[model samples]
Target: MYCDESGFTGNDLLDQGSTYFAYASVAINHEEATEYVNNIIQKYKLQGGELKGRNLLKSTKGKKVIAEILSTFKDRIKVGVYHKKFNLACKFYEYIFEPPLSEKSSLFYQIKFHRFISNILYLDFVCRSEEAEKIFSDFQNLMRKKPNYLFSSSETPDMSPLDDIKTFCIHHRDTINQELNSLQGTDIGKWILELSTSALFSILCDWGKEFNQLKVFCDVSKPLKENKELFDVWIGIKDKIYFDFFQGVEEPITFNLSQEVQFVESDKFPGIQIADVAAAACAYAFKEGVNQNTESWIEHIPGMVIGKSVIPDESYTDPNTLDATRNLILLRYLAEKSINKQPLLDGIEEFLSAVTHDLNLNPSNRIATIAENSRSDAPYFNF
Candidate 1:
């Protein structure tokens, strides 16, 4: 597969106006991609170079070419989309509340906890833009250090990022917010916040499992190039079981990946150019909303897209609806492994019960459930 990304704002995700990030992997060989590019160039009487996706989306002819390419090779393409704001919230919750960074796991993580936390943060960031901006700014600063950052400090910890989060939670003491108070004066270490590397690996894992082996070609990406060794370790992870310390739940994931990727220039590889177009177009469709120009592209995306945005539109979700709540639980479960089904269901029920109580307290407030409220009827493909 050939890969490329679009709308990458690096770690500066909040202010860049690049609300969505997309990484696309196209399953077309070099010869086919080359032929298609040559044909398009000859047919359109256009300049021959790297057929940039961003440029292609500009004009009627370019858009037509993109539409044709998408329609022609819809099944062979796989795109991963990330809602930047939601993604940032998820990162914050994961680092502060889950796994190696945080000492213990929270029961909330199992039952749409990430979403719950993200919704709260998302709202705070949206409603209180200045304060929200500072939170992200502090977070970006905190993540630039070497040596493991400590979360449980005996001495006074740097409170820039941690305090920002705590202040937000303390100001509004809800269930999720109060839970965030655990990291009041702690720190989360440096983690590469870019989406491309992880997204590419996920696509590789899925494709690798299907093909048993893959000869991958990625357009020269700094993250992919720098984290080559990390990718190797991730694919061949021996300890597949990641235990949730809070619930004593062991989530085991087995990967069938066994290959190294080759990072090449898009100018030399037509396949990578095709991936570029697909990724850029996909990101644009989501970020700009599906209009007449983007509707055709959306039609080709449903099954091919492997998206991470649990909540596409924050407000469209109806938290009071049991079905919506159930779907979120289901999506979370399906995305990760659950060895014990009954307890998981019980957990979901407990969360729902708590939601009911919370709703009764403030009937005017709408809870954010997972909803597909994009301009087009494009389905979200999780996992």
Candidate 2:
């Protein structure tokens, strides 16, 4: 039950339509998971230098300070570097320290910098799930090929899972603070807080089996408001069935109701607005798809199950959407847990008919105008 969210927008608060938020929850077997991770960390450390106080991008030029620290550990600590744009220097300054630092600021800078780097490294490690083994292998191979540019680090000292997670959040908070001071006109702090919240949610989802049975629900809006008529069919069915099925459960269920609010000022649909909604929708869809197969008494029903529901105008086509769709269909066969699919399908059909009847009764109000101006210069693509 691990849930996490990522914002595509630079400023989550001020920047309205340009930002996107993505939330995901994954469940993984816990038996020996921590030990496995620790083992991986140890293996990484033994190849080179010591594990304590290592920087993420040590090999990068801007992080020469980090390189120096690692030099002490030598071959005892092994650092894994991802050679992308090599923007470590920019990110370092951007995520740590204010301008015009005096000699006295060295200690302050070091503390903040180490915490930030450690968290980033930890995240990079956690995100490497079995599904991403190929990507990790490829990345490792790339690092091997570019020997000079590759960076690596030893694992953090042993700690409980909760403690390690809290440490990660605290470091994230420090990094966000640094970003707030160095960058202008944005509430990066709030964004990080949201990320932390989302991350905690993901962690819970990952370990959901340990908790009492919980049902998680999410919404998928239409691409255009006018398409609401189409979207309503599915939404209506879901609402009816969900409420009917779990109207008064003793245990509370979790509902993740996310709506993409447009930030653009123009009457026409903005690219940013569409991108944001689309990203959130995809994240929700993917999580549902994955969990549908893995959790008993949990169902994964796509908005399409209701039929003709117009997704919000803010929703746009993205690779994640297709991935989510594919996963949902595959879950029927690949999931380790068994679910009662008949109720879900029956609910879908009933809701679809009811919604279709309602739409027909009010043709004029059925269409919704998502934007003040309908036309846009932006290119349109289907998800």
For TM-score, the strongest prediction is: 1
Predicted candidate 1 versus true structure: per-residue lDDT over 1-383, tens digit per residue = 89999998876667566778889988887898999988887887767666899898888888888988899889888888888877777776665444321322443555455555455456556655554555555555544432332222223322222233443333222333344444444321223466776787667655644464467788887767766765666444433333443346443233333466788998899999888988889888887777988876677877778633233454323455543344343334422322222322346556567765765565443333333211112122111
lDDT score for residue 25 of model 2: 31
How do the predictions measure up, each by TM-score? 0.68, 0.22
lDDT of 2 by residue, 1-383 (tens): 21223333322221323222343332222233234334533545433222211222222331232233223222221111111111121122234322212333343233233223223333333344331233233333322232321112132412322123222323334343453445333333323222223323333222232433322222222122222232223221222112212224222113222222212221122222222222233333333444432232112223111111112221211112332122222222111121221222224335444544554564432222112111132122112
The 0-to-1 C-alpha lDDT of every candidate, in the order given, reads 0.61, 0.27
Residue-pair clashes per candidate? 0, 44
lDDT of 2 at 44: 52
